[model samples]
Target: MKQRAQGSAGAGTPPGDARVPAQPRPADAPDGFRERDTAVPAARAARGEHTHSERPIPEPRPAVQRSSVRGQILDALRTALVTGELKPGEVYSGPVLGDRFGVSATPVREAMQQLALEGAVEVVPNRGFRVVERGARELAELAEVRALIEVPVMLRLARTVPGERWTELRPLAEETVRAAGTGCPATYAESDRAFHRALLALSGNEQLVGIAADLHRRSQWPPVRRGRAYLVADAAEHMALLDALISGDVDGVRGLVSQHFAGAG
Candidate 1:
């Protein structure tokens, strides 16, 4: 038998020895990844979406008397989640979100804690948080809850509030329908939220308004796409509810709200 080469593999010396030299990485390898990171901003510029450094980055605005950076981050996160930018069931870290918001992880974490309380996300120990998935069943349950709360309030308002007050809100309600008619989801969502908020504001209970607003925002999770005809039908329903309130038909208002919730689900 031929003798093994000297120093190649003495007994007990493993093949592919630990002392083997590492091959040089290619020029396009991840070793120089930061240089390639600029491509994203360049592409955004091409598409007319200016990069952060291109535009003036303003300092965060003051909230009430003090600067609440955590609140701002929470609001931003909520917007992102509602718009489907932060997809349901996908995990996101504080550092990653902090980088996106141009803030620190501390505020991002604080905001995430609030989101956990709202049932918008679930925290994963040692990992991060993920947006909660809301299925059709969950949405239907929310609609039911909304009907239970809103129908009674609307009934009272119809009986007590003057008819002219509802008529005055006609323009705003119509604007919401117009927004839906335009087929812009964001516009319709905001206008729809505004309409509900305005209606609830008449209650003169800030706490009630806040709770209803939270439910309204939550119900919008996983937005469903309906045809223009559907939107028109929904708008008509809103108008009918207003008419019932104007006519002081408490029974009619209740019936209309029930029908609206049924149709919505």
Candidate 2:
């Protein structure tokens, strides 16, 4: 995994700190999530790495590693799509996103193809890809499907999975809360996806888990724009849902799951 800043500022630091170096993407990180730059050029300057007559070391720009460039670009696009940066029905060229991440168009095209398969974007011949618009009806349908698939599965897990097994998943829930607290759209979106994915994985049904994860990703398109209070409440609901499951309250879990979908719709 690569270390990077987890804020919503994207690759760059907050404005008014132009000299701050851009954090470099790590070679092995799958998710191209950006983080605050830990590089300290000032310390180097104090060590005489630069003087008044010489210029400071240039900040490294955000980029994808060649070994996993396509995957990272896909991750970046997912974040952008989730945060509504990639607006629905808006066509975007590979060169444009490539330039944004300081990478080449090949990986961007590859990534866009994957997003196309996910139904998040449609490829435009002789041009680029356009983000698919998700209407209210589409969202409602998605929520319905999720409720249909997940509710029973969760209820059964609550009955079958031991309390200790569920307890071990507390950390994932806690991480989701921490990400929600940060209000970083990408981080929170991914963490929220992760928490649910892990919970469903307890069913030991890979096919079901994959389907649920896909639905989860689609649900995140045009991600929640609500502020911290909403996210905090959302996180709390996740914990509450977990508690219901851990306590083997099948009825409570079913109701909570239904309520969650209702709220999502």
Q: After aligning candidate 2 to the native by TM-score, how far in Å is the CA of 214 from where it should be?
A: 0.6
Worst 10 residues of 1 by lDDT: 15-24
Q: How much lDDT does candidate 2 score?
A: 0.82
On TM-score, the leading prediction is: 2
Against the true structure, what is each candidate's TM-score?
A: 0.67, 0.73
Off by over 4 Å in 2: 1-67
Q: What is the C-alpha local distance difference test score of each model?
A: 0.78, 0.82
Clashes of each: 0, 4
The digit string of per-residue lDDT tens for model 1 on 66-149 reads: 338888898788778756788998999999999999887988998999989888999999889988998889989998888888
lDDT of 1: 0.78
Model 2: per-residue Cα lDDT over 1-265, one tens digit each: 1354544355565443434465576676566555442245543454556545566666554443553888888888998998888998899999998999998898999899999999999999989999998888888888899999988888888889988888988998898899889987778878888889999999889999999999988887866567877777778889998898788888888888888888775
